[model samples]
Every structure is written in structure tokens, then in C-alpha cells.
Target: MAMGKTPGSSDDEGDSAGFAEINITPLTDVMLVLLIIFMVTSTVITQQGPGGGTKTGLKVNLPKGGSADVTARTTDISVAVLADGRFVLAGNVVAEAELKQAFDKAKEQNPDTVVIVQADEGVSHGTVVQVMELAKQAGLGQLAIGVREGN
Candidate 1:
């Protein structure tokens, strides 16, 4: 009787060759854990800033490692932003687009005027930022945001 070759088998019976794609579930799990860790750590880092006290939404202890910067004197101009995006200075409601001129007038009277920005919790961040830009254009060197001490 003659020996016949196996149709689908390799001639070298003892050797094996194959390539297979592996699933990425394990890698995905590891990335998710790292993401969670970074999220928690970032929250902790922003908590403490200069002045030895913590205010709501403001930095507390000085940021780590980098040289600390001394902030310039804030001008005494109070810009109150209401919840509805109205810009008010000294109790007068000013339109959002007219802030530059108003700030110029304030600066002309007092060069040392510091712009203090006060915003309600319900007010949008964009409204507050607009007021800040106006203060800068008004020729004031100092800009500070007002925040509650606690809560």
C-alpha cells in the first residue's frame, strides 16, 4: 500500500505557523483607570493657592514649583455683572458693547483705578470675561475677580 499525503496538513508535521489579532479590552481598561486618576489629581492641584486661604472658584495656596508672581494693584473700578448679562458700574446699567468707552472715562479720571469684577453665580462666564476685557482696554493695569470667601 502507498502512503498518501494529508491534503490540508503541512509537510513538516511537528511545526506550527499562525497569526491572530488580539482583543484590546485589557488596554482599554488600563487607560480608563489612568484617566480617573488624572481627573482626581488635577482637582487636588487647583485647590490650594497663595495667601493661605481658599475662596470659592479662586486658587488657594501658591502653585507648586514655579516662581510665584506678585499681582499688580487692582483698580477701584467695580463692574457688577448681573445674571442676565447686564454690565453695571456704580449702579448704572451699561450695554455690553459700550464698555470700552466707559472704562476709558473711568481711567481718565484716575490712572490708578483698579477694575474689580463681580459676577453672580447664575451669570455666564462669557459675560464676566467681556467685562474683564473692557477693563483692560480702559487702560487699567489691575484686574481681579470677586469671589465668595466660602460656600
Candidate 2:
């Protein structure tokens, strides 16, 4: 009797070969998901505007100037000086002495901590300077004046 080869059967050598084509469906799906995530996050960040999204909820008329934008950092301290002469440190109303103590504590935690002072346009120059001076005295060398970007 003669031996016959069956359909879909390999030769007696028992060699098997796999498809060389690569499947990219999973890769494409991952890349699309990552792209969507990045787009959503970027939109959220831009909507938050500058000041690192640290909303102190104290609305102050920021003086418009041609100063460069300062990127706020988490390690930075934000102090708001209202026109009524009250100081809001990190969203809490604090006296000048308390503000100084906060600055000192911040300096102790991180010598490179930056102090961002946002004073109302009606606030006296002396008041703003006082805040800056306190920050300087606390050994926090980095200081920034918050201002709206305009002419």
C-alpha cells in the first residue's frame, strides 16, 4: 500500500513556521489611550491658568505688567496681601507676625523655597515690600511678585 500525505499536515521533517507579520492592534490601542490622557491633562492644566493652580480664593486685582511668567511650584509659598491690609498666607488669614513665622518655618523646611507675593493693585508699595522683606529676612532668597500678564 502507498502512503499518502494528509491535508494541512507537515512533511515528516516536523518543521513548523510562524507568521512573520507583527500584530500592532494592541500597540495602537495603548498609544491612543496615552494620547487621550495627555490631551485631557493638558487641557485641565491650561484651564487652571498660572500660579500652579494654588487657588487661595482671595480675589485681588493683579497689576498688569510685562514681567515674565513665573511657574508656581508646590514647594513655593503664596502670600496674598489684600487692599484692607490683611495678609492671606496659603489661603488663611494671618497676621504679619504669623506670616513671618510661616516664612521662617518654610525656610527651615527648604532653604530654596520661593515666596510668591500677590498684592492687590491698591495695596501700598510699602506693604508689598514688607512681605518681601520678611521673606528675605527668613533666609528664603528666592522671591517672586505675582502680576497679571499685560501691557
Candidate 3:
């Protein structure tokens, strides 16, 4: 009787070694997609400004002034006075009568809250002062005026 080769034994005709190659194309594609997602999110966060609050879309021509340390804080409230005598608080249009109430609510949240007034150059001086006065009545003592830095 002739003896046949064992089933577990490797012969010269067939190599039993499994595939050693690894495909990295799928991994690379997933990593690139994640990188793009992070890039877009970071840009949106930065554009929201330091305070991370919504900014008004009004096109106000800010007055040019000398540079100063006017960094926005988390406890700061932004108010925009439009040339047409409209008041916008934190990106929402509010009536003049309700402006004081808004400031009062902000003061209730934080006693050290600072009110930043951003009035257009075409707005009347009295309008700006009146806004400041309302903030004071709301018990918000800290106030700031927003201005564009002159070259």
C-alpha cells in the first residue's frame, strides 16, 4: 500500500501561511473625515467671539478710537443701538421700555455683569447716554463703549 501525505502537513505545492498584508485605505479615509469635522467646528466656535454669545447682524459704523484693553468677559452683556433708534440686546431686538428689564435680569444673574454699549456713529449722543443710564438703574454699575480701533 502507498502512504499518503498527512492533512496537517504543508507540502511544497501549497504554502499554509495566511495573508499578512493589511489594508490601510479605509482607516486613512475615516481619519481624514474626522479631521475635517473638527476643523469646521473650531472655526464656528471662534467666529462666535470670546463671550460665546450671539452677536447682532446690524451694520453699525463704529466710531474709531485709540486701542484699549476691551476684552469681552462671560459676564458681559452686549447692547446695540441702531441708527434708527432701535435697541438690540444680545442679538434680539427689544423695545426701549423693555431694555431696562433686560438689564435688570442680567444684573440679577450676576452682580458684576458689565454692559457693553455698541452704538452706531449716526446714532444720537442722547440715545447712547440713555442706554447707559438705564443700565445704571438696573444696578449694573460696570459699563463699556464698543469702538473700532483706529490705525
Candidate 3 residue-wise lDDT, 1-151, digit = tens: 1136554566676754444457999999999999999999887665554441435555678899889567777778888889898988765689977888878888888998888898999999999999999999989999889898999
Q: Is candidate 1 or candidate 3 better by TM-score?
A: 3
lDDT of the candidates, in the order given: 0.60, 0.80, 0.79
**Clashing residue pairs in candidate 3 (N, C-alpha, C atoms within 3 angstroms):** none
Residue-level lDDT tens digits of model 1 in 6-111? 4344555543333334689999999999999999887765443211112223322221233323232423566667677676665466786666776787688778
Measured against the true structure, the TM-scores of the candidates, in listed sequence, are 0.47, 0.63, 0.72
Q: For residues 1-151, write the lDDT of model 2, one tens digit per residue.
A: 1135444457656643434357999999999999999999887666444442345766889899877577777778888889988998766789989988988988888898888888899999999999999999999889988888896
- The candidate that wins on TM-score is 3
Error of 3 at 31 (Å): 3.2
Model 3: worst 10 consecutive residues (lDDT sum):
47-56
Those runs of model 1 whose alpha carbons end farther than 4 Å from true positions after fitting are 1-75
lDDT of 1: 0.60
For the record, the alpha-carbon RMSD of candidate 2 to the native fold, in angstroms, is: 7.4
Which lDDT value does model 1 have at 92?
Answer: 60
Q: Please give the clash total of every predicted structure, in order.
A: 11, 0, 0
- Cα RMSD to native, each candidate? 16.6, 7.4, 6.4
